[model samples]
Target: MSEKSRDINFLKLFGKNLRSIRESKEMSQEEFSSFCDIDTRQLGRIERGESNSTILTVKKIADKLNLPIKELFEI
Candidate 1:
């Protein structure tokens, strides 16, 4: 696979994992976005892997979820 394709694949997996954890916690996208101080539409894009998130944004999400940053990368 090309480097770009690999990156996209990883992003999708990460997004999927994030969504799974959020759902397990019974948090809706709107609620989670508000708690994380992120825009709801942006969060949706991130969850769909349609947008790349900065490290700080990732940290914010981890902090809001009360999870380690590494957990977001878990498949």
Candidate 2:
């Protein structure tokens, strides 16, 4: 596979993990965005496996969702 394809696959995994965690918390993307003080569009990108979210972003998301950072790993 090409490097771009590999990156896409990895992003898809991350997105799936993020979506699962968000759904498990019973939160919408909009709500999560609000809680994290981040842009909804950016959150959508993360959900769609388009953007490479940083550790800081992940931590903010976890904090917003009231979930432990460990929960993200289980994905």
Which candidate number has the best lDDT? Answer: 1
Please, what are the lDDT tens digits per residue for candidate 2 over residues 1-75? Answer: 999998998887888898887787698989977878989999899889999989999898788778898777575
Candidate 2 residues lying further than 4 Å off, grouped into runs, are 66-70
Q: How close is every model to the real structure, measured as TM-score?
A: 0.95, 0.78
Q: How much lDDT does candidate 2 score?
A: 0.84
- Local distance difference test, per candidate? 0.91, 0.84
Please give, for residues 1-75, the per-residue lDDT of candidate 1 as tens digits: 999999999889888988898899899999989989999999899889988999999999999878899989979
* Backbone clashes in model 1, listed as residue pairs: none
Error of 1 at 26 (Å): 0.6
- The whole-model C-alpha lDDT of candidate 1 against the native structure comes to 0.91
Superposed model 1: Cα runs more than 4 Å off: none
